[model samples]
Target: MEMIYRPLLPATQYCPCNWQSDSTSLHSLPQSKHASSFLRTLIAPYAPLWVNSTPATTDNSSDDLECPQANINYRSAFEQQKREAAKKMDATTLMMSLYVPKGRWQWTYQVPFENRPEEDPVTSNRIWSLSVRTARIYNESITYICKLYPREVQWEGFFSEVKLHKTQLRPLHGASTPALIGIQSNITGIQLAYDIPHHSFWIQASPDMPDILKRRCLDAYHQLHAQGVLHGNVDLANILIGGDGRVQIINFHKSRSTKNDPKVHLGLATPQDFNMEMREVHYKLNYLGAREKERAVWENRRNSRQTPSRRTTRRRDKDPYAIPMEPPTDPVRWLIPDNWKPKRFIVPGQSREQFEYHLRQFLLDLEKSKIHSPSEGDKSQGPNRRPPGDRSPPPTRCDLGKRKRGEVDSEDDDDDDDDDDDDDNSSSKRVRFLAQTNHDDGSKGKVRSPPPPGVKRQVPRISREYQNFGESPKTFAIPFISS
Candidate 1:
C-alpha cells in the first residue's frame, strides 16, 4: 500500500479523534504497509490515506521527504507571523485605552487624575492632557508611582522642561526627584517617561518623620537653590519624602532658572527680576517668621500652663506652620527656642523690608538685654547704688592695734586717749549717714533732722574744715541733750 499524507491543518484548528481498532498481528504484512496503517490510526482525524500501489523507494525518499520539510517550514513561519501580529494588536489596544506608552512600564490605571474644584473656569476647562498616572514597574523590584506625564501636550513649557531635564539636569539621576527616562511622540499622543519615586509628596507632613528627614528636605531645597533653580510651587505636596529618608523637590514645570532669563516670573508671586538666591532667601525668611510665630504661641501656652482646647488643637491641625508637639531633637531647636517671643516691629504703613529691619533690631536688642541686664529683684536699684544691707566694713584705723598694745609714748597716749574718747562718744550717739539732697528752696547746703520731743530742730550748715576737738561733725546729730 502507498501512503498519501494530506497537508497539516493549523495548530488552532487541529482536533483528535477517538478510533478503537482491534489488536492484530502486523508481522505478517510488509514493513512499509504496517507503518502506514499505524500512522493513519494515530492521526485519525487528519490522517494519511493508504492506496494499493507498487512502492518505489528511490522516488519516495527524494520527493516525499523534501516536500514535508518545506511544508513544516511554511507552517512555522505562518504561526510566528500570527503571534507577532497578535502581540502588536495587544500593545496598540493598551496604548489606546490607557493613554500610556508600552515597554517596561505597564499602566495599572489605578489612580485617577486629580483636579482642584477651586480652579478658575478657564483653567478648569483647559484640559490637562498631560496628567500623572500610576503604574507598576520593576527594574530590580516592583514599584508604584504617579509620575507619568504625556510628552505631546503642544505646550512650550513642557518641551522646554523635557530638553532641560535631558541635557542640563542629567546629573540628578536616581535621586528623590523625578528623572527623565524616555519620550514617545506618535499619532496617538506624546508620552514622557520618568523614574517613579518610592514615596509621594503628600507624606511630608506626617508626624512620624524624624527631624533628620525634615532637615534633609531643607537640604534638598538648598541644593536646588544652589543650582540656580527656584521651585515656583514650593507647597508641601511638591516636596517628596522617600522611604529611605531621602527628600526631593519636584513639580519643576513651573520652575525658574536664574541662569536663564531672570526676568521671567514662571507663575510665582515673587519679583520677576529676582534671582534664585534671592527667592531662596525670601523662602527661608518666611519659614523663620512662621517658626517664630509658632514658638511664641508655644511659649505663651507653656507660660500660662494651659492645654490647648480640642477646638484650638483642631484648628492648629490645619495650620501650615503647625508642627509635632514633641520638640525637635536637633540643633535647629536651639535656634527656635520654645520660650522665644517674637518681638516683631510693626509700623502702620511701613514697607515689608522696613518692618523686617525693625524686627531684626528688636531681636538684637533682646540679645543685648539678655547679656547686660540685672536680675528681676535688683533691677529697681540705681546703677551706682549697691543693694541694701550690702555695705562694706568701716575703714580700720592703722594705729588701732598699737593703741591696744599699751606700748605708746606719753604724747602718743594723749592722742590715742583723745581718739578713744571721740570713738566712744560717737558709738553712744547712734548717728546715721543719709544721702545729701539738693533743695529747690533758698535753704541750700543744709542738713535737716527730725526734731526731738519738746525741742526745736534747726538745719545744720555744711563745714569744709575739720577741728581737732573730740566733737562730731556738724553734719552729724546727737539725740541726747548735753549738760
Candidate 2:
C-alpha cells in the first residue's frame, strides 16, 4: 500500500480573485527573472506595487531585488460559503467552471476533513497536503491549477519537473500535456503553477471507451518517447481525458529524459524503457475495458434477478419506438396487416408526415410507370422490334455459304424464336450467353454478324424487383443510353 501524506500545516484560504495591492496574501515569494515576468503579468491589475517596481532576479547572487514581505493568512470567502451553505450549494458548482475560459481563476479552499466526501478520500488528502488550489491571473482568463510542496520533501521533485517542462516537454504544452505557468519558492515550500484545462479529468476505464481515445493515449506516449522523455509512472491515474476528447499525460515527477539524464543515457535498458511504457499503456487500456465489461455483466445479472419484468417495462416506456429484444407471447400483439403502416415510422432529418407523403408519391409514380409499360404481346417480340416500314436486305451469297458450312450451332438455330420471345426479359442465362459470345469473338478475332440497317446493338437495362411487400413488384428495366 502507498503511504498517503497529510500535511500538518493548515490549508491556505487566500484566493487570487480577491487579492488587492495592499492585500498580504503572498509572503516572501522567491522567483527567478523568467518567473517574475509571468508573476508580474498575473498580478499587474491587482498589485500595482509589484508591477511598477523593478523586478527581482533570483539568478544573480544579489538579494536586494527580493519580493516584499507581506503578512500571509489562509482565509477563503468561498470556503466560508461552503461551510455556511453546504446544503444549498451544488457539489459540481465549482467543477462546472473548471475548464471555462474565465481569464481568471475561482480558487475554492481545500475540502475540510469533516465535510470531505467518501468517494474522494484521496483527493481531499492530496489537496490538503499539497495545498493544491485554483488561481486567477490579473489579465489572463485561463484557469491555472497551483500546487505547493514542502521544501524538504518535494523541492527536488518540483525542480526536476520544472526543468523537464522548460526543456524537452516545452513543445507539448497545451497539446498532449499541461503547460507550466511559473514557479515560486519561499522559506516554507515550493509552488508550481500550470495551465491545465478546467474540464480535464483523470482517465477512467469504461465499457464504452472509444478506440480513438485509446489510440490518442498511445500517440501521447509515442510523442513523449520521441522527445526522449520516459514517464516513470505510465498509469491510468496519470493520464487525463480532456473536454475536447484529447488525451493528456501529467505528473512528470518520475519522468526522465535520455538527453538530459546521465543515468538514462548510460543505462543499458534505455532502449527497452520506451517499449515497456507503450506496452504498459496498452495493457492498462485493455484491462480497463475488461473490467468495465465485467462490471456491466454483474449489473445486468443483478438487475435481471431483482426485477426482470419491471426493467423490461421501463425500457419499453422510455423508448416506445425501440425494437423489442424478445418476441411477444401473443403473435397478434405485434403482427400487422399488409396494408397497415406504423404511425411512428421515423425518417431522419424529416417529419413522419413528410416522409409518408414522399413515400406515397413514390408508390404513385411506380404504379403509373407500370400501367404505361409495354404490353406483354409487344414485349414477347423483343424490345429491338423494328418499325413495320423498315425492311431487311435479302441474304447475300457470303451469308448463305457460311450457313451451309455449319458455322452456326444447331441448338442456336432451334432456339432463335424462343430467344427473340425472351429478349426483353432480364435473366442470368441471357446475360451469360452475351458475355461468352463477346469473349469468344474478341479472343478468336471473329466478327459478329452485322445488324439490320438503322438498328443499334442491345443495351442492358437496370432492373430492380421489390419483393418486400405481400406480392412481388414487377421488374421495371430502365435502359441506360450512352451520352
Per TM-score, the best of the predicted structures is: 2
The C-alpha lDDT values of all candidates are 0.39, 0.43
Candidate 2 TM-score to native: 0.33
Assess the local accuracy of residue 384 in candidate 1 as a C-alpha lDDT between 0 and 100.
Answer: 40
Tell me the lDDT of model 2 at 471. Answer: 57
Candidate of highest lDDT: 2
| Candidate 1 segments exceeding 4 Å error | 1-156, 186-188, 199-202, 205-210, 261-483
State the lDDT at 243 in candidate 2. Answer: 34
The residue pairs found clashing in candidate 2 are: 13-74, 98-198, 99-198, 99-199, 103-140, 103-141, 104-141, 105-136
**How many residue pairs clash in all the candidates, one count each?**
0, 8
Q: List residue ranges in candidate 2 displaced over 4 A.
A: 1-132, 139-142, 154-156, 186-188, 198-208, 262-269, 287-483
Candidate 1: residue 245 Cα off by (Å): 0.3
TM agreement with the true structure for every prediction: 0.30, 0.33
lDDT score for candidate 2 against the true structure: 0.43
User: Taking the tens digit of each residue's C-alpha lDDT, what string does model 2 give over 119-174?
Assistant: 11112123223212433233212233445565456334454566677677877877
